[model samples]
Target: MKSSTIRTFTTVHTWTGLLAGFALFIAFYAGAITMFHDPIDTWALPKQELADARVMDKAGAMMADIVAKHPAARESIGVTYAAGHPSHEVAAYWMEKNGTWMTQAIDDAGAHDAEDHEHGLADFVYELHYDLGIPEIGIYLMGIVSVIYGVALLTGVLIHLPNLVRELFALRPGHNLKRLWQDAHNVIGILSLPFHIIFAVTGALLCLTLVALMAFNVAIFDGKLMSAFERMTSALPDTAAMTAAGPGADAKTNVPMLPPAELGAIARKAALGAGATNFDPDYMRYVHYGQPGAAAEVRGTSEKTLGEYGMVALDASTGRIINMQLTGARDANHATYSAIFGLHFGTFGSLSLRWLYFILGLAGAFLFYSGNLLYIETRRKRRNAEQPMKVRAMATATVGVCIGTCLAISVTFIANHLAPYFGAEPTLVVQPVCFITFFAAVAWTFWRRPAKAAVDLLWATAVASVLVGVLDMALHGDRLVRTLAEGRYDVLGVDLVAMAMGVGFGWLAVATRRRAVEGDPCSVWAARSPRVTATTTPAHDG
Candidate 1:
């Protein structure tokens, strides 16, 4: 393409990134915490703290109880396993039509009266970051934004090609107008380029590929694709079919199967034989329970993701193993499918990989935000005031989405704690409230002053999110103290992260406020030139 063509694309890249930047930041920020979903869940629940806790028996008794009450759970659903004591299992969830269903969390031990799900808060934060709080639509839109983001990255590289070397690591903090922003934008983007690339590739693929995949199913895979997928999924055998109470059949013959602990033990043995260790099977299911063909299965995970080797499904009746996919053996087609999901979800590796991704994802968000500033900066002098009013309106929109993201995230942490006391759904309350409050902030900022809006929102995010970190320590200091007392490393994981973010965001908030009060060194907020009235000779006078 010609240089001009590339330039036009550069503009597209710049605008898209800027407009999408703030949301991207929230996504990255929250997503980094989500990497510790299990740990967070641990921090939230802390089951191990129970003085009477015994991990093994808990699994069996819980499963037996859940299953006996919800017997129809046999054929329809898979299982979920945990790696705890007393019982390592919940019966896989079984839903009948719409929302009506029986849970498989327990068997013979008798079932509880609750639904089979957990973790309201963490899951909500995750969804917000990825989907922007909308389900299907939000994810898809973010994907589109990601693709355009790639374009912006390419464009940025080209524009700065000549000066990149000299200004590459430059962070000239003082009075130079262009130099300051130029340095801030450039250094951050370059330092985090790899992160940007990974997120863009993964994010776009996750968001935008569904339709393309559907097309692949149509154009490439024969109509048999769906069936192929289903068959490839493991089967459940320990579940029972509906009894007709035929002429000779005993309707009362049904007895719930073995204790969950025994079945879990069998599962662990099988998984070990299959070359998978740390078989913390916490969920169980019987596909055809009591009918002589019933099969039970267990599924769970290891500490970090790499050793997970995925899940294994086995033959329940004989404790005879049918198929397994724990390690590298996890069949190719299935592996590709799984890998895409893994890479997108940021769950493919060891500690280092996850952290690497966490930092990069945040950088990617910054890239988008910077692209926006570059866009407005490039054009302000030309349009000045005389530019069409709609052009001015667009600037307002970009600022809203970007700053709005920071504001919402800052609120999410506060909302998490507050929502619980109000007897509200923490996730629902935290998310929507964050957004609504953020939108209000943006509108006020825009009407009041766009530049000021940027500065204030940043500060707001810094305070709210940072304070959340501080408060977490303050509220949970006892627990953290216990963690230290017990010499458990994971406890420090939560503590250090919270305190670090608290300190960092506090600093950022102060910085932005100072910048606004002192006047930013850059003409960062310079307005477009005023429009000129066309002069004409008065007909009579002339």
Candidate 2:
């Protein structure tokens, strides 16, 4: 690449990264934690005792009773039979009139009246990644950010193409701060290029689905986008017919509904017959439950395949198989689509792959953080007495948003640990607490110098991260020991990861403080101080 072309590409890379880096940082960091979503849920609700097999065996009766009592459940209901988390086992869910999901768990006595407490820790963190916990507009905003991120990735590759191979392994730690940051950024970016590309494409697809549908309807599909979507996702159960059937239709028509246990067994057999050897049904949905036309769809994970979740649809009334969309049985196009989702969500492989994705996600977060630092460093005034106001502002915002996001996430862990003592709805309280902590950190950055703010916020995040792990250990030390002995590592894994994050953040805080004192004096990251310049009078007087 020519110098001029490289500069233009560099400009494109810098601006796009600056525009999207903050949101991407939050997404990547939260996403890293969410890769272990089930474990985090287990960590938050550690005291849940596992229900016996009898609970699952009687799931059909329990679900029927639940629908009988809550007529709205007849519109659509889902049963979870074998969730790894105890709280999630044998749970039933239905959509309310207000479009909210209501859930109930089957107790040890095989009743459906067990209270469903919110599992906010993992869920809230997951929400923060894609939507920043904002309901309506957050997703669209993140969609746009993902588009910009894709652009940044392309332009970055263009700018670095010439020296990419030569400098692939270069990491020069020297007096020049910008060079050090640039080198670090390039190495991580190059190594994780494929991962970054996958995230960009999948993220845009996930977040912009509705927007793209609307656009296609208006532009390309001639108002047939919904029809096209229906065709594309035909494997999923059709809930509209079930909803239109209304409650008690089967009872009025003298049709018998199959019990939940029978439906589950049929679905399992159908899934296996369809070639999913490792299928374990997590969710089952019934349509027209009790009528002769009643159908059941069981969706579950299939291990050792890229298609993580597959569906087996069966006739609930006669135990006849209707259709199977198992992992190995999917059509080429549908299988590719399923593989994309599985890869993006880190559900395609075993523990080793999950850890790889987790580490890469955190490294992706670092890539954005270092990009921001490089931006600040590149724009610093070398000969001027003080840094530009814009550079200083960018520095402050980057420190506030990035570090604050980490702090808020750590605080949420603490909030989850203390939820019982707080005696309130943990979901409602934890979200607000995160928002307050994030905005307060931003506000504090404005009050203090950029360097001091960075150091302080990083330290705070370190403390909170370590504190969450310590608190968890204190609360569930015996349980952790027992689970470890029994080879149940979910909660223990989460705690260990949290403590590792604390150590990582602590090291970053120390390094950032050291840089502020010892790095280039003219840089925005350095603490502002008056430079003393001594002048000697000429010898012209002699």
Candidate 3:
């Protein structure tokens, strides 16, 4: 490549990476945790189990209670089952008069509002991965960021491809800090190029689908884009037949309804027989539950398929399958649509695939981290000269947002464990606790030097991670032992991962402190002037 072309690509890579780096950092880190979302939910929430003999009885009762108290729910009620260490109990949910949602959990004691614990942590983390926790616009913003990331990825590969063969594995360990960092960054980026590409494409397409539809509506379809798309995607052959009265409307009839378990069984048989390799009925949605025209929709996850979830709609009164959208029945467009989610979330495979994604996701987070560090290192001034203001700001943000996010998440875990003792709802405390800790850490970074703040926040994250894991295990030691003996690894895995994170963060904190103390005096990371030498000898920390 020509020198001028190299410079152009480098500029594009730098600017694009800088623009999207922090958001991608949060996304990657949170996404890594979300890879084990079910396990985390199992670890965090109280487990409830009903005997096989009584499970159907409890579900039926729960469904009946929901319809009796909230007649509006009879129009469209969903019964979500409690499958294998469910984060929550078997419950029914529907929209209320004010448009808010209401839920009723199964109560063994026959009491109202038995929904005690809320496993919102996993969901919140997953939201952070996609939206940075912003409501309406955040996802769109990340979509734009993802587009920029793709450009960065392209230019980055362009810059490195020329030297790929000779320097791919040439990770020189000594003195020249920039070369070492670049070497590591290049290796990871090159080796994981495919992973990053999947994210860049899927993230953009998923988040911007609505935006694209709107654009196409105005530009090409003459306002028929959404209608056309809906017509194509509708599961029901006759969409009008599936329509029902809005919330707060009364049911057309007061006839008896079939048991939930029976409907679930019918739906399950329909889905599996339609070519789903594995189906576990998780949710059943009923329209006009007690009416002659009542219908049911059952949705569940399927194993070892690109389309991870399959659904069957039934005529509830007769247990007759009305429509099936299982893997074998899906058309090309629908299969592709479903596969997007499965590919992005690794839901098409077993536990081993999830573990692989988790590791790669964390490495993706480190890629952005290292990108920020490279920016700071490249812009450093001479040994005796003052560092640039932009360099300082980037360093501060890199430490504050990246490290602070980790600290906040760890602290939120601790808060979740302790919320019940204080008579607080765990779900209610999640957002406030997370944002407060995050902003405080950011404020601390601004108050202190970046070098010192990085060490402080990392150490804090380490301690909190360790405390949440070890202390929780201590409180539930007997249960842990029993579960271990019983071959249940969900809770044990979460606790162990937490402790491992602590160890990782602790090591980072010590390494960063060491780099700060002994690095070049003019380097932004250097805490103070070195007594041993005046010569510039930069040190790096990753």
Q: TM-scores for all candidates?
A: 0.76, 0.90, 0.89
Q: How many clashes does the backbone of model 3 have?
A: 0
| lDDT per residue (tens digit) for residues 1-542 in model 2 | 67898889888999999999999999999999889988887788777777656777777777777777766677568887765566566778887667777788776765545444354678889999889888889999998998999999999888888889988999988777688889999999999999999999888888998998899899987897776675465454454554344454454453556766677667777778666777777788776655546677778777768878887777666777767777767876568778778878888888888899999999999999999889877777665547688888888899899999999989988987787887865666778889999999999999997888999999999999999889999988987898899889988888888898999999999998997776655566666644722342212110
Global Cα RMSD, each model: 6.9, 4.6, 3.7
Q: Which ten residues in a row have the lowest lDDT in candidate 1?
A: 533-542
Better of 1 and 2 by lDDT: 2
Query: Mind giving the per-residue lDDT tens digits that candidate 1 earns over 1-542?
Result: 57887678667656666656666766776777777665555554332333122433554455444445555544344444445432233444676545575544443353445564533556766777678777559888888777777777777777777677887778876654345666788888877776677677878877776666667678889765654555454433112232232232242344455654567677778777766646666566665554444456565555444334355555444566655656556767556656666766666677787777767666665555555555555554332224344435555665677667666755766676566568875535765776688678768767855656665666676667556656666766777778679776564676467656656656865665564455422233423222333342211110
Residue 487 displacement in candidate 1 (angstroms): 2.2
| C-alpha RMSD (angstroms) for model 2 | 4.6
- Using lDDT as the yardstick, the better of models 1 and 3 is 3
- Quote the positional error of residue 390 for candidate 1 in Å: 6.3
